[model samples]
Target: MDGKRFQNYEAYFTILDTGEKPITQEWLVSLIENHENNLQYAPDVWREYIKK
Candidate 1:
């Protein structure tokens, strides 16, 4: 993954585990939108993963 995208995932994981703060849906959407071109899987894949 690109550095920016990796950082975004890391931030999300960190927040998820630590309860430092909630990761906003808008921020997650923005991160995916920003890295859409670089993603190996489509956004639907991520949505499915999140649903699980």
Candidate 2:
């Protein structure tokens, strides 16, 4: 995966785990939708992760 893309995902995950601030589901969905084609790995990865 590209460094920048990984950074974005990591940042989001960090926010979720820390719970310092809530991230909306729509915002998370939008992030994945915007980068669905540009990031590495198949879309199934995102689908599976988000589905959890």
Deviation (Å) of 7 in candidate 2: 20
User: Which portions of model 2 miss their true places by more than 4 Å?
Assistant: 1-21, 35-52
Scored by CA lDDT, what does every candidate get?
Answer: 0.47, 0.46
RMSD of 1: 14.9
| lDDT against true structure, model 1 | 0.47
Model 2 lDDT per residue over 1-52, tens place: 4545433343333213423444456555656776554333324444455667
Residue 40 CA displacement from its true place in model 2, Å: 24
Give all TM-scores, in the order shown.
0.27, 0.25
Per-residue lDDT over 1-52 for candidate 1, one digit per residue giving the tens place of the 0 to 100 score: 4545433343334113323444456656667676654333334445546567
Candidate 1, TM-score vs. the true structure?
0.27
Model 1, position 11, has a per-residue lDDT of 38
Estimate candidate 2's alpha-carbon lDDT, on a 0 to 1 scale: 0.46
Q: Give the Å error, residue 4, model 1.
A: 41
